[model samples]
Target: MAYSFPEEVLEHVFSFLRSDRDRNAVSLVCWSWYEIERWCRRRVFIGNCYAVSPEIVIRRFPKVRAVEMKGKPHFADFNLVPEGWGGYVQPWIRAMAASYPSLEEIRLKRMVVTDESLDLIARSFKHFKVLVLSSCEGFTTDGLASIAANCSNDSVARLRFSRTSNNVSTTKLLNLREIDLRESEVEDLSGHWLSHFPHNCTSLVSLNMSCLGSEVNFPALERLVGRCPNLRTLQLNRAVPLEKLPNLLHRAPQLVEFGTGAYSAEIRPDIYSNVAEAFSVCKQLRGLSGFWDVVPAYLPAMYSACAGITSLDLIYAAIQSPDLVKIISLCPHLQCLWVLDYIEDAGLEALAASCKDLQELRVFPSDPFEAEDNVALTEQGLVSVSEGCPKLQSVLYFCRQMSNAALITIARNRPEMVRFRLCIIEPQAPDYLTLEPLDTGFGAIVENCKELRRLSMSGLLTDRVFEYIGKHAKKLEMLSIAFAGDSDMGLHHVLSGCDSLRKLEIRDCPFGDKALLANAAKLETMRSLWMSSCLVSYGACKLLAQKMPRLNVEVIDERGHPNSRPENCPVEKLYIYRTVAGRRVDMPDFIWTMDKNAGSPEVL
Candidate 1:
């Protein structure tokens, strides 16, 4: 006789479990646990929006309060995906509005969001608190104004009460809390949206409008910041000049993370003192970012707040190695750093010496298309950081040249690396020292790093590197490949292995139908597979779609008529994913949806 936990006891136990993976595992114990877990689940994450229909989601979890959904593939950021490649949030928002009225948070990435959808979201969820749209597009400032004006339902009730009684105060009517729009491409119609927020609304805790290209109304912004006492994170755009920063900082002295505007003001004594005094009072500041059009003279004004900063982002500053070294020496407690390769090896060495607690580092290429190794950054800079920062677990380094010996040493130094993305500027670049493929170097990375999860490969790679990855990268979840791999055998090695691989993106690789068809069943276990400029034929895509009714195999070809292409002709782009939603209806002319019942692919 097996004993079962009481329903209330099970619910209470499930409430303590936060990880989506753990909750999913718990729900699979039995039918009883499934029902119990379903009822208790409050937040749900949909990695791919098309993986499951919103109707299925509503049926599975009836009381969800927060939802996080991703739309397009990661390569969409590089303009590889077409305009109407179809990852719209309208359908999901409409369904959730009808079902989950109490939803408090909605986080979207790489998705299409129109002004109508924004207006709907602002008006639908009465208790909405957080809205994060990262790397999203197809929206304007008019849509933002809609959100600012009607985010909270209490505003209406407060308005009615204030009209009825002259003594009643409507200072704290709005309940909206956070609006994070990082790296989103929003059309700058106007910056007057800040004025739409209810006067004296004190609920905002985090507001990031740094991606906006237009200037915001300064008076409205100052008043809003002054009233929101709990605001902890504020990221301004480049339009907000450096001189106005001191005023905003004075208003929000409790900010924990701050992204400044253009740091290029006149080197006047009064301006410098005002900026220094404002930063001195921000005792709780821990993260600093944004310095667009930076003037080296104004850099010293921020030195007072550098001691406590654990995360520093100088990717946009374009400051030279000398100024970078001066700032890096001051941030002794720095843990995460994002900077351009303008820092050079000397600056990185200085960072390694000063910031011993660094955990993550990202070095972006200021001039990616330059054929020459002009920036003076190489594998040595990363090797230096690996030697100094013992706790380093992640790195994204973009360099022109690398050596097998340097990578092996770095891997040996940082065995705890979880995400390693090395993008050699030139495609299929070989090792500079020996002029050989980068197999041994990347092979050393997977073999040594036991916790490697996300990997982006570059440089000249062959089938041998894939063999190494298939054997050692047991926990790898996401892989990005471009202009590498020798043959279909390379793709076969990865598909046959990598049990936890959830997202696989490949472009300009030699893989084709054989590897994909042989590992057809593996696609159902993963989230998605995106391959473009490969050798995958239309016939192979159709067969895969027919064999697996649960999967959505889409062919995206913008060349010409979809029906004119032959069965043996290679597809321009193939997007395959496991989907319970059957088929998406928003696909444009270029996208051809492969149906199980149909003999050939059909354009919707």
Candidate 2:
């Protein structure tokens, strides 16, 4: 087929090409392609690895837009890439400074920077709009002063100095619309000094100064928000301590995204009420989080405040009443709702009724309920919810009871669902769960949800469940089954059917090494695997890993199990077998071996 569109469409298609080798293809194409070369401004990995440098390679394209220097140490010596790979990285950062005039964004990562580099960047990169010097330890606020001095007249809009000790003279920062000093260790600063933040940074959309050490004031943050009315997100987790949340929220009405950590009583009489009152002030908050775990009293108030929020991340927010119905009803435009609570079917039923437009749902049940937890919902609620919410792409549940019938109903109703969470709340009560295998329910998930890409199953699942998985779920790419009694059925079933699987995590699932060796060869496409338990066997570990050389396998022992009743005892004997080669070598069985870390990765 011959291309119909002009040079511009193809140029846009090649915009994501970050590799150096592909840039050569564009250059060799034709003189017509030279016009498109300038569009490939986001050059990646130059100098050390390749003979050609960006300055030389980008000769035909002078109007470069951005450059990302990948080599850098996040901590003192911890380079983001391998140690030997960094000598190839610094030359490119120098190249970014020397070249690229039209550059708007520059990310100089790790600790691979110097004062001179910062100066070169501040002075040379005139239109450096977004600069992220994350984990770059060689910086001081004076370097930032250089940027403020040079790019004061330029379009340096957003500056993020994350995990850096670079002391930024807050007063010198006057051009940026968004200033992220998140996790930046500045020794001395107060709310008063923060007043100097570039008031001209009017386009500031997100400001994350949460981890920055400073006695912040709502007045200063309000000023920051007032100057930039378009600001949508503000994270002052502990900046202002607990004293200034209300003033900040009330002043910044345009703020839609907000996150705060635990505050001091000086901010509000009681932490809960103060946080609740603070939340109530934000009328348009779309995405809000923190202060995890909520009490019933605060639920209504939170809903009242974030009335217009579309994405609510109340990971620890308390929701006890059917008031969840009123909350969703209040936020009629709500799209994504995450309740990190021991959510009951009744509450979910209410949520289903009120928040019909929900696209993604995450519910974590923190309560310890008996086996009755699984019977909360019948097959009908699943059908109703899956059918009712036409836009729902992902559903996650923890505390709620789930049966085979309900899963089938969900599959029958919403086959296009991308992600699903089925959990059985194991109780600590004296009576055993009598392990009723919901064959019907597990089968529905495997067969129906054709678009099922991610699945997380909680509680104990047995080996018999494998046949169910092998029969239905072939499209799964990521699977997480955490905290369960000894069971190998699910693992075997998954390996047999889920051929396209890429990421697999079996947390606290007792699938010993023998089972792994048996199923190892079937999982060739798997790229990442995490087994956190002592149930893995040595023979299976080598067999699987050796067979799939590409497997990024991590086998670790989670020694301290959830000291809860239903949780199993932390494996103690497995520690004796780990070897560099792995525990329990396939050659023979012995009481112990000199290889300390050997049987380790195997049965771990």
Task: Return the lDDT, model 2, position 253.
Answer: 70
- Give lDDT tens digits, candidate 2, residues 242-317: 4456667766776788875443343323655655676766666787665433344544446566557787665545
Tell me the lDDT of model 1 at 563: 65
- Give one digit per residue, the lDDT tens place, for model 1 in 424-543: 998998999999999999999999998999999999999999999999998999999999998999999998989899999999998988999999999999999999999998888888
Report lDDT (CA) for all predictions.
Answer: 0.91, 0.54
Displacement of the residue 391 alpha carbon in candidate 2, Å: 2.5
Per-candidate alpha-carbon RMSD to the true structure: 2.9, 10.7
Q: What residue pairs clash in candidate 1, if any at all?
A: none
